[model samples]
Target chain A: MMQKRTIEIGVGVFVAAGIAALVMLAMKVSNLAAFTNQQGYEVTARFDNIGGLKERSAVTVAGVRIGRVKSIVFDDKDYEAVVTMNIESQHDRLPADTSASILTAGLLGEQYVALEPGGDEAFLKPGGDIKLTQSAIILEKMVGQFLFDKAAGGDGKKEEGAAP
Target chain B: MMGWLQRLGSTSLSVFERLGRGNLFLLRILAALPSLVLRPGLVIAQLYSVGVLSMTLIVISGLNVGMVLGLQGYNTLVDFGSEESLGQLVALSLVRELGPVVAALLFAGRAGSALTAEIGLMKATEQLSGMEMMAVDPLKRVVAPRFIAGIISMPLLAAMFSAVGVLGGFFVGVGLLGVDSGAFWSQMQSKVDLYDDILNGVIKSIVFGCVAAWIAVFEGYDAVPNTEGVSRATTRTVVHTAFAVLGLDFILTALMFGDE
Candidate 1:
């Protein structure tokens, strides 16, 4: 009987430990639990190319995350990516004329929205859109353009030399 | 040459025969699983012995492994000037691969060997035969509970392993090495995905548990009724479980993360 009680207690502890581990895992991996009830205001921004910018990516002001990308949708009429950001209440003092740019952490890492505040007395409302926005830079496209320019310049120089 | 061919054929045939028998034994244990609810005491006892007893080693090894990852990862990432990502590296490695695989290996070594030995000893002493004589189904009464207990305990043990490993990484990265504590945690939270990394790991551990428990119980049930036979069966249980766990881990990883 004593052994039976001890075994029961052991099983209980084992189960509790399992639950605790699972809770910790969910928190550590998802990161959603922490901000589920966060008081925030949503703002929109338009960009030509969002690239690999994912929802839930951080929105940073001066390298500190103040919010997250709430959702993303494509504006078919304007042919642009419409990104919605949920800024925490504490960061509600962002100016109306602030510019948002998609920036990558490290060289080839996750993309986030970096906000640069402007010197404006007006503050951004909950549904206000940030008109000044910069899209993600595609490395391959940039490299291709650089090579094309170099080849084009070399061809012109060679043709001038041949004519002379 | 004909004699050699005959020997090879016979050996292959025997191997297939053993495999078939092992499958049948596993089927019997699984078929008796429904009856386990009626014998909760038996299952609980097995759970205590298998799961609870194995916790200490799992936690200790998990912490040590995490610390090693933290130290190594910090050194490497510091070279790249991205030591802030130490938590991400440690958490991803532990949750995705080492946590499940290492915990399962340890389980096989600690609890699996003990299970095989216990059941094999019971067979050698004719306890199984006696149970049969008493009209009790030895597989249902003895083996089913243990199999279920192992299956249930495996995922829990693996989760515990990962949690402790993360804590260990935290200690080495933040407390000892002067890494910014907030970056260590926030980086991990932002990088690791629940469905991709953590859930997949839990699935791996669960599958490993099933394989290890199946091998252990089957080996014991099929052991020859002698001291030597019992010892050999226990050894085979450890060897077979290790191979099965490792092989299954590769296949699962491919299926889970292959596209990425």
Candidate 2:
């Protein structure tokens, strides 16, 4: 009888410990747990290119996180990327003329949306759009442009001087 | 040449026969599961033996593995000047793959071998036959509880491993290596998803649990009813669990993480 009681107590403790671990994982180790309980409003932003921006990526205002990118869909009509962002209710005072840009965190890190708020009498409302947007910069395109300009200048100028 | 052909054919036949037998045993255990509810004590006791006893091994291994991951990830990411992402690296890898896979393997080694040996010894000593003589179904009384305990234990063990592992990584990264504590935890939280990473890991552990427990109990129940047979069954349990866990991990990973 006494041994059975001991076994039960041990099993109880084991189960409790396991459950506590799961709770910690959910609370401390994942993002959804933080945002799921809070109220948020969705707003759309359009970009020429999204680069590596993914759903659930951070949306930050002045380097402080305010919300998450809720969804991304291709705008067939405009030939652009339509991004839906979920901004926390606490950050509702963002100005109407806010600009949304896709920016990489480090040199080669995950892409996120950065919101640059413009001073306006009106504030951004739910379902409102951010008008000013900058697309993600492609490094290869910049490098190719630099090389092309240098090549054309080097050949055309050098040949003119030599022939003269 | 003829003798070799005969031997190969017999071996193939026996392999099929064993597979069929294992399936039948699993079915019997499933059928007996409903009755297990009437007697909770059996499962609770088995839980102590199977789950509680294995806790020490799981916790220690999880801590050490996390520490190693933290150190290795820090060293590698430091070269790129991205040591702050160490938390994300540790959490993602541990939650997605290492936690479930390692915990299941250790389970097979600790609880699985013990289960097989315990049941096999009973068979060898004629306790199983003796129970049958008394009109008791050994499958119901002996096998089902152990199987239930094993299946229940694995996911919990894996979760604990992941949680503890994250802390272990914190110890190495923020404490020793001087990674920013805020960046360490914040990056991990933002990058890892509850549904995608943690819940999927739980699902993986559950599947691994079913496979490991099924093989362990099946081997024990089907032992040759001799001293040598019992020992062989114990060995087979560990080897089979390892292969099944690793192979299934690949298939599950492709299915789960493939889209991402």
Candidate 3:
């Protein structure tokens, strides 16, 4: 058996180590900083279709994350998806005419909103609507379009040959 | 046939009786908790035994588990050309499932069994009766401190296990396997949510801690006063804790991560 003082010191060290581990987990493993940063402005952009564009998806400028999609609500009046974005205050200088397009990170990855700045002196304010917005490119729709074009091209060649 | 029927009935009655007694024991522990506040030294001593003593096992196992995950994750993900996601894979799996479950299992084996044996031996040697005779209340003096120690140490140990495990994964993934260190960390940071993953894991560990401590103390207190009884109680502690932890883990995972 050890001395009482030694046991006490050992316990104190053990507790401190455990707390340090939790802190390390928060800082190194999880995006705790991003989750707690609430001092940001909200902006809305309407898309015709938002495929897999979920809430909290990254809103990036030139592939750099500057904001996140705060919420996604359907505009029943305009029949479009109204996406609310929370942009960091540091990124408040985005051009009024900046175009927003939904983009994928990789060949098959999460969808995010990408901003392309236009030549406009005015900056987009909080709650302002972005008029130039491109909807997400649905993979199924693209595949169907490609098959339809191929069949039409093949038929066109057959028709030309028969006419000749 | 009559004797067999009587035996089955008696067994069922004993099972219910045991459950009732366990509940009563837990209530008594709760009642005796205030005594711990008065004598913090007792709890501290138990903490040294339960938490500090188990540190080596937890840290080593954590590293081993993480390295294995990194190697296996890299192998499977390399074919898909998504090896960069190895950090995310390791972090998510560790935080969400393996860390708490495995750590709790180890704690039950290392500390739970020991607690049961110690208390059982004390009972077998009539230490508890001695305390009772002196009006010291063994529940407040002996059992409460050990129970409190197990609860306090469980979550901390699990967190340590995960933190060390992540470092192990980093070593194998970036240090040896030539993965881009920036991508490894950045991917993990971007994907893991604090509330969804870390907080959920903490909740699981806390619950597991309570389950393990409760079973250990109860088994010890209820053990028959003999050498064989003490041995049997210790064995039962490990076995029962394993079943409870694994079963509760499945239920918790389904509750927390089912929709996600």
- Winner on DockQ between 2 and 3 is 3
Of the two candidates 1 and 2, the one with more favorable DockQ, higher being better, is 2
User: Could you give the CAPRI-style class of model 3?
Assistant: high
Question: Which candidate number maximizes lDDT?
Answer: 2
DockQ values, each candidate: 0.58, 0.89, 0.91
Query: TM-scores of the models, in the given order?
Result: 0.85, 0.95, 0.97
The digit string of per-residue lDDT tens for model 1 on B109-219 reads: 999989999999999999999999999999999999999999999999999999999999999999999889988988888788888888899999999999999988888
Question: Residue A19 lDDT in model 1?
Answer: 73
- Reference-based TM-score, model 2: 0.95
Which structure among the candidates has the greatest DockQ? 3
Candidate 3 chain A least-lDDT 10 residues? A31-40
* Docking quality tier of model 1: medium
Residue B94 displacement in candidate 1 (angstroms): 0.9
Q: Comparing chain B with the reference, what is the TM-score for each candidate?
A: 0.98, 0.99, 0.98
Full ranking by TM-score: 3, 2, 1
Model 3 agreement with the true structure over B1-260: per-residue lDDT tens digits? 99999999999999999989999999999999997888998999999999999999999999999999999999998998889999999999999898999999999999999999999999999999999999999999999999999999999999999999999999999998988999999899989988899999999999999999999999999999999999999999999999999999999999999987
- lDDT per prediction? 0.91, 0.95, 0.94
Tens digit of per-residue lDDT, candidate 1, span A1-164: 88889999999999899879978988865565656757899999999998889988989999998998999999899999999999998888999999999999888678999999999999999989999999998889999999999999999999999996
Ranking by lDDT: 2, 3, 1
Question: Candidate 1: where is the Cα deviation over 4 Å?
Answer: A28-30, A38-45, A61-67, A70-98, A106-109, A116-130, A138-164
